[model samples]
Target chain A: MKIGQFEKINDFEWRLPRETQPGMRVPVVVFASERMLNEALQDRSLEQAANAAALPGLRGNVCVMPDVHQGYGFPIGGVAAADYETGVISPGAIGYDINCGVRLLCSTLPLQDVKTAITDFTAALYHACPSGVGGRGIVALKARELKAVCEQGSGWALKNGYATAGDIETTEDSGCMEGADMEAVSSRALERGVDQAGSLGAGNHFIEIDLVAEVFDSAAALAMGIHQGNLALQIHSGSRGFGHQICTDFVQKFQTVARKYQIDLPDRELVCAPLKSPEGQQYLAAMRCAANYAFCNRQLLGHSARMVFERFFPGAHLLNVYDLAHNIGKIESHQFGGEKINVCVHRKGATRAFGPDHPALPARFQKTGQPVLVPGSMGTESWVLAGTAAAMEKSCGSCSHGAGRVLSRTQAKHQIRGDELRSRLMAEGIYVQAGSLGGLAEEAPQAYKDINAVIACIEGAGLGRRIARLTPLAVIKG
Target chain B: MDANRPFSGFAEVPHTADIALDVFAPNLEELFINAAKGLYHILGIRKGTKEVENIHISMVAEDREGLMVSLLNELLFHAANNQAGEFISLEINEYQLEADLLMLEKTGQQKEVKAATFNDLVIVQDAEGFHTRIVFDV
Candidate 1:
């Protein structure tokens, strides 16, 4: 677990061969600059990546993104594919916040037109979008209605008039996963989901208004409806308590299941069952329910945000650019060892950066690529990148999700004052609304790696190409 | 309040993204109580003024680690429902846990913990006491 142990494949790629660890079934391929590689060594992320390599029926290699940080059993910003029929599905590998992802909404309003009204605009959003710990949503659903939301996802929103047809077209999987089973979801998860739709949960989740500072690929930018100097809104949230409970319930159950399957993992958190097993199917069905719940959750949040924008700018419209999941397990076909195979790709803190002409992408993006949203740390520049064909060949069409954390929350809170940070951001012309100053302190920009460097590594590795860069105008956080 | 006594305690541990806690106690029951306190600490919770509500829970798990995760997740479920529990009493025998909790209406909380994870979780008995590190998805 040191920088020297990795065999340098290039400036942006390194390989920890399978021989480095006894139980590993595949090599761990990490995409990072030398500096980022050093950062990965600071935590147990590389070790965790190696641990992930040992999962049964693993295919190709375990790919680690530049933004990786140590997460429970699997490193955040990691991707691993396992054979569909023979491999295993791990809840820990997918993460607790199932389908935690980002959605970018583009607007026609120029930053210059809304610069003076940011404070009120942010306040309006803060009010319209319920946030903070244990904050309820705009409407609480009955158990029966919650089940529909779980099964229908954003389609449920479309039926209820919260989403437009265009929104569904732009969403990944049309905002619904096909195999979600209400029977597989626990009643406890349904109870937790009852009042959580349309909410922006706390802990690294936020709603930000940004100025499209620059466009690198005008064609891709235009395709995504993002114009330079215009404003865009990004929503970062997930399935809320519903997903957490499902993952908790499954990860606990899978411990016994793993033993039953004779799967010996290096860590208990990495417990898993064969993808073909009844236990695996049940977890997949349950996980899909949470994933669909998250899609609907974001759709509702987007609807609320659009209402706020319309109220502020009268005729303004916030159009969906693209919505993609950062944490998910998808059965995808990819070339492995010169043969195409269906594998379950688990992306934790990684986005699916599908290249141009990929059939999964909507027709509008066929000429360009799927838009990959990478939100930087607070007050930093976020990037909208286009997926590249090279990504399919090299990293299983995966890319970094965000500027990963470097400092612990406690360390950040100890080193930075939330009030001072807010004042400083305001002085810099970035309006800020947060639930607690203490919470704000924990998300200080200094706590994360340099986003620009992370983006550079992505481009260098040919995983994604920049389309536009966005600078924050206002931020609302839980 | 007695659960927050001297022989058992918890402290925050450094984790890159999530919050982690190292809890230590002289025995298994104390360890579970201290872990609950650690969760509340990570939440930055303060006691409420409402009348206390008593809750009783009984759970069976595959092992001690499973039992610990079940306990913390139960506490998290209660916290999400607006009732933050203070441990009234806890008993651990084999892989089963039975506990009585005094629940307080959640009044002030500065943070949110998604769930407690079993990542690298192992209860070790050493010369000092029982020690384990629990990582909470934030």
Candidate 2:
């Protein structure tokens, strides 16, 4: 509950021993600076992390990133690996926005080349991509088409001419998770998915036009198609209402399932079902449907942005850099304790940062490692980092998602006026377009921790290595 | 909106990453109604000019918390479909809940809430009334 209670493992590593918390199966390993550790103690994040460690059949330790903050049941920037055979899977751990992730598309056009058209470009993108509360997508899907999206993910996008081969190749898991059974999804979730394939829902989701400010590693940047002074686009969203419904359905159902299994948890939100149980398998199958839906959602969004890019600048192309999910549950083989074993890695508000030579990565990134896109708060610097081999050993190939919230939404809204925040951003040469001023105020940069410090902690812990830093030229938020 | 109502009201609470509301009521039905109003407030929803349509909802759950979550999620489902429900009448008995609502089209909404989470959701009844805190994933 306090910073002084943790056992200091190193400058950026601290451990809350299993003995510190009753019923904890493993220690809670937190990566943070002394200041960050204190900041975490300000909230219930540490306690949530300890709760996560108590989950059944946990392996290694519950790894909490520096951007950690209190989430529903588990800490936001938390990673826990459970033995594939005996562990339990909880819907709350993966978050409501199933594959809530980030996608980056780098273009060769330099910022100076598009300086005059920045406003128009931003407006065009806003029109191309639907955003805000209850914003319908570009195309409404029938039930059959929605089913295809649930199973094929970006592959469906490719067939429908909304995605490029390169885009699918660069996406994590090639944009599809296997074993997503359509029958497993509820009709309500299907209805929600039918009309929200490409819409960017409100609350901290955005499409940003960024200028590559600096390149830390030229080779890695080149591999990721990021160049200094050039422009890039970032899409941050998820499976929309579809994922929300699936999670809600499962979390509700799991309540009874947990009782049936006699699994006692500190928080009701942490209710889980055994991995091999029929209920767990059904949830997994349904969760994958939402995951694939999110992958296709990002692809469609990228396609729309690409269309706007082509219309504005003739012959210009938006290349998919790398797309990865921050919130997900995946079966991955890792070196735990001594031998390599398969475990279900649940990353909630965390990104998979597979280092170089990991077999899961594509051949193109075999040497450079997976690109981890860490977007800062609006008007702040976003960073592109490469996964490190050290991450595989220490943090279950996971890193912080973004600058975690330090203030509540109500606090942010009360402190910062939306119009004033917009004016300040405009003065800084960062063009802004938001659905609602109140929503804009809730995501003010002041409400978040220092992103630079978060990245420094990641680097300090060798979880990831910085390759490029990006500054926003324009931002579109919902 | 009903903060002045004796023994039944709702207020926003501070949460790091989501929207949380503290609600209190004299009974289960009042608690459910206050929770619905609190949800709409968080969403910043404004009523549309369209005519209201009447609808009824019936649900059965395992316990009081389950009943509460089911009621809120039912409201959210309608909200997601562009309808905002105004409670007309409500009834509750143990684990079952039934309500009549006047549904109106939602023309303006500022924020989007994903789901209502059960994190630390404990409805407690004391000498004054019943009180609980609900955290919504936004």
Candidate 3:
């Protein structure tokens, strides 16, 4: 049922009345095209966005990007900000795959070179990088060493000869966010992660070899090292079991403290406590650790891919385009309704798209803005976009993470066969590797809302501007 | 007698098993306990063959949807690692959910824990029997 209180601001924007729900100190907004909106309203995401507005110390409107969908507490593609002092932190908002995100690498080789080695290259990647359900990589760590990874993040990979220095520079937050505490992570989480490093865990995580099918912003693309038909690799993964266990641990443990702190919520999934509370602080600390683990996981995997490329091309050069996290929370200063305030921004299934001149941006891209890497489902078109000033004024510089799931896994499995799907991709000149057909079917191209539509909404809503479009030539699914 | 028996998400005529146990309650505590019982029931853990231990576990997700993915993973870990066949009921009155786990082992030996995926469980809302099913690697 519609909440009856929201005002349709435009074809792509809607605003929730602050008074529509009790405990809601701020309004909530959603950005979606008509098509996306129709699909999103079918689930509980909009209601969850409203519920997020009810959280204490919420400043600015709780915002939902075009890819909004049903999730635990905060809807995936939902963004909210809380007062750092009075606000609360909930692990649900950061997600199980903490820092589950995407990274893009630009290769100098053109389509000629890539296609020549296409099958062999894909097979090499499948062999070099571990993927599929419970996939494991080449490196394994024990207890003490795993702690170092959780604590130091991508730097750990750099020091251990897994990732290079340039790689660290190109990643968001240099692939490590501050405030990670290994002590906050449980032994079980550590155990799960030690063997998971450099691996791609299942469920929508993928490594795609793509060709720059089109470049809309030529100058920007040139600056970022792109040529039409050039080869690029995209890695999509996250903290894996480590992040999962941490989020699971906190969600079940935070309940008592939420009640003790008298935090009111419309759903049990939204349970949270004051940001400075013992429970909240602990979650943040642990969340950072997971986020860092994810950064390292991707870094290690990328390094492995780079090695394979180097071995194959021998003379080819590659450079990291960028790495960005889709799920995370951070303290940032923003102008909310004219007042500059410090708030904790929670982005779940949403990408941070900080515009030009944002102090947090790398000195080089500060003029061009952050590179938002949106990985489409395998056998589809991914995108590269840049943050804009419009986003800075709108949803705290955020955009949709990907083409949101259109069909549930059960439905997808019923609709498609893995072998058929693989054959179809191969017919289109795409090479595909997957651990399970059931998994491949579940993440079939048809299962996701149109990625082009999602990107158009982001552009239409002024959150980000398109730069380049990538079409997968080969894919690795975990 | 049939009505009183706990309805497993599995073992239904249709033979499903995402949500193996469906119990009713007017309060929160009972809902959690029944949920735990439902999980153990699916693993086929029985009474008296094992000892119950206080097992502390937790999970987080971007939202509740992801929570289910993490929660089942923990239960699967215990079942695989510690031979925890059934997780005993406990107080869920607080905002957080808590419980004790019971492990059944023929002898102390290493067990393989194959990770659980979202595909393993099915959840459907129903009045008669909440249908469910799970397939373990072992």
Candidate 4:
């Protein structure tokens, strides 16, 4: 696995042809600059992407984004589609936290109006948004109630007065997947889900308040309710323990099932079962339950955030911008080889950036394309982009999630002490609320690659169009 | 704290987006116990002053790797879902692990690890007895 072995498709695209890997069924198309590609070569991201290409009945080339990094079995920014009839669905490929995604909410208040209230506002947000390690959620639900949440997603949030009507409309799949089977979820997973319904779990998840720093395209930015100097909130969370348990249960189950089907996987973590198999259906049902749970989870957090804004600034209001999932396996129809075919697209650290006019997009966004939320690492410029028609033909309607980690937790700690990092960030006018200083150290901005460059690569690869850039003013992390 | 002292069984390993731990123990039982302690350490579990009762946990896996994941996940389950319990003792065989977790009031937990992943996970025996690497999704 070397950069020299890859064929440069363009400035932002590289390819490891089928001949480059032993069992690769299709080529591994990497969307990155030469520098980013070299960085990816330092890890096993390309190798994992090739392994993903080796999966059974894979349709399109395994696509790796510019912000690529080594993940468990597949590259973090890898996207692969497998035939619905003959493909395989692996829990490992979809990641442990199902539907771990980001939501952007633009506020009516401007930063200058709230500048003096940031400290109190951030503290209020931290208090309202229950975060950190211990409790994943504040609302405890009974088995029956939990089942309803799993089925209805953000709808349950709306019924419970935790979400607005516009919130559901702006969310992916309207914040609920249709096929979530309550019976498919295990008791252990349900127990894990009970207490963590509206909580923000630790590790890379956060709540950030930012102002629309720079607008690349005012039309698209206005379409997304992102205006320069306006406050926007980014809620990055997932299904919490609920999704983790679902993935854990399925990954463990698929271990034996993969052997049962005699699937020759390069890595054990890449273990999978046929998409049409009993095991696959069971996992998909359970996964959808987790996905829906995540959708509801973020909505509840949004409710908490809204409460903070209302309490802090009397007239502050918010409108849901967009909510999108970064890690998921979805059955979608795509133009493949001149035919419309159904394929299960597995996105681990990738996002669905369906182009404008895509039938699946919400009516309001059809003209502007789906809003792509890329919340960069703490204290950096996050991005809001629009999915393009070019993305649909190239990268399976996918784009980079964010600036992927470049340093390990231990390495990050060795580089800077958490308290010092916090103080430094505070001195720079960025309010910080973290559960643990050590945890904060691991998420330092330098631990990640250059996000602006990653976004540029995404644009260069024609996966997305620049819309708005956000600069962090305050952050609450668990 | 004395009971926890002199117990250097595992060390934190570097992972990009998750928590990874490397456990080294003389046998299967120690490996299981050390792995649990490693997870609790990562979670920053704080034990209460008084113990209430003994909670028994049992898990079975097809292999050592699976067994290790099950035991760690079992600890995570109790940590996340249950209001009480800190692992105090662990006993293990080839394929099964049994442990007694102490439950008490006012127990505090800092981090909740979601699950143990099988990504590049392996338990290999060597001259140092047995060593294993586990990745946790937080």
Chain A accuracy as TM-score for every candidate:
0.99, 0.99, 0.97, 0.99
Q: What does the lDDT read for residue A110 in candidate 4?
A: 83
Q: Which stretches of candidate 4 lie over 4 Å from their true place?
A: A136-138, B1-8, B82-94, B98-106
- The most accurate candidate by DockQ is 2
Whole-model lDDT values for every prediction: 0.93, 0.93, 0.75, 0.87
Please state every model's RMSD to the true fold in angstroms.
1.8, 1.5, 6.0, 2.7
Q: Write the per-residue lDDT of candidate 1 for residues A397-472, one digit (tens) a residue.
A: 9999999999999899999999999999999999999998988999999999999999999999999999999999
User: Which segments of candidate 1 are over 4 A away from where they belong?
Assistant: B1-7
> Residue-wise lDDT of candidate 3 within A372-454, one digit each (tens)?
98878778899999999988788988888898876665567788998999999999989998877767887899988888899
Q: Which of the two candidates, 2 or 4, achieves a greater TM-score against the reference?
A: 2
Model 3 chain A: worst 10 consecutive residues (lDDT sum): A1-10
Candidate 3's error at B132, in angstroms? 11
lDDT of 3 at A150: 77
A1-478: candidate 4 lDDT, tens digit per residue: 8888999999999989999878899999999999989988887778889888889989979999988888888879999999999999989899988999999999888888878988888888888889987574757788887999999999999998888888999999999999999899998888778888989888889999998888998877777788889999999999888898898888888878988988888887888999999999999999999999999999999988888798788887988999999999999998898998899999999999999999888888898899999888899999999999999988779999999988887799899898998998899889999988888998999899999999989999999999999999998988
Docking class of 3: incorrect
Residue-by-residue lDDT tens digits, candidate 2, A1-478: 8877799989999999999978899999999999999999998999999998888988999999999998899889999998889998999999999999999999979888879899999999999999998778977999999999999999999999999999999999999999999898999999899988999888999999999999999988998889899889999999999999999999999999998988888888888999889998999999999999999999999999999998998877889999999989998999987899888899999999999999999988999999999999989999999999999999999999999999999899999999999999999999999988988999999999999999999999999999999999999998
Native contact fraction of candidate 3? 0.00
lDDT of 1 at A357: 97
